[model samples]
Target: MTETTKQPIRVALVDDYDVVLTGLAHMFDRYRDRIVICEIDANAELSDQVDIVLYDSFAQPESDRQELAALVRNPRASRVVVYTWNFQPELVESARTQGTHGYLSKTLPARELVAALEAVHAGERVVSEPPSKRVGSAPGLDWPGRHEGFTERESEILALITQGKSNAEVAALTYLSVNTIKSYIREIYRRIGAASRTQAVLWGVAHGFSPDHHRIDHWLGGP
Candidate 1:
């Protein structure tokens, strides 16, 4: 008797930023035989039925139970996994309580990410070891404002501001100090030639800083 080959895990990437989801989708390119990116949803509905929905938590509130609950309730997704940089104990427990199958770190390499997803698809609840405070984002990831000389963190701050998040709200969401958020905002203003928050919002809106609401199916040749 011959053993049957396992099928690649169908995955849907979920996030509000197109650049963030697209960059994440690229990380799985080398693992195409094991993971197939079925959809890339940006503030959009999960249209396809997939084995896993990898929710990238970029520029989103870490403690958003409503969003997590919605994903968990989606019948199209067999499981929901959080891909985040913030690993606060409360946040992890909240995700678990909300029925997330995995709470993975953003510092995981592409290969390790694929393996973790495989474990999730195999019915195992996977959680990555907490990454060090000094660890940055995984290599080869991209975000908006990269071409404008904004670091990923700075871009996140700007993106939040564009979404009408106050300085305190941004601090709370990203776990950054208010002073630090202000400093990043100052630098963002300088780089974008904006001196006021309204100006910054206008600039961000014009420069693709707002959250997207569409699917990037074409990235993986989906119809």
Candidate 2:
């Protein structure tokens, strides 16, 4: 329970196995006053009784992930937390794009879970730190910032494409319309003399896109 005296935050707990769910439920029962675990159900629809959801790994089939994404898209679906032992960088990256509020490994301590939940409810992403650096932080993609190559916007959009983000997702991240992203992508292709995303990516790799590389144009100076 939160000693801070805020209204109790509703949470839903889900696990297919009764033992796991009961143990977690009992643990959360101690904090019911501040972080109420409203319902403990196995394989049940979780839309009611909670503002946030803590899902287990058994809930990770493709259909289930889509369901979770839908939950995150709800008007009240503000916080979607996945508490699973099976954490993958690829899955975490994908889930982040889907708007999950947090992704925690199940083996974390009780206090860590509470802190994660608190952060999520506080309108923050709850990915564990030191955070994995798979997505952003690609310095080469800051094209505009570099007199060396692309405009900042172009570098970013191109980086996501190379990392395999869909145009729709790239649009969401950049706050650009999907067609706008397409236009930027086309512009990138034209600048690179590449006709398609694949060729552009290959051109990027040939030039430079990471810590270990730098583009040829920076040295060759626009042939």
The candidate that wins on lDDT is 1
TM-score against native, each model: 0.94, 0.51
User: What lDDT is obtained when candidate 2 is compared to the true structure?
Assistant: 0.59
Taken over the whole model, the C-alpha lDDT of each candidate is 0.90, 0.59
After TM-score superposition, what is the CA distance of residue 97 in candidate 2 from its true location, in Å?
1.1
Candidate 1: stretches off by over 4 Å: none
lDDT per residue for candidate 1 within 132-175, as digits (tens), equals: 97868898788888888887778889999999999999998887
Residue 27 CA displacement from its true place in model 2, Å: 1.9
Per-residue lDDT value at 116 in model 2: 77
TM-score of 1: 0.94
| Winner by TM-score | 1
Measured with C-alpha atoms, the lDDT of residue 33 in candidate 2 is 61
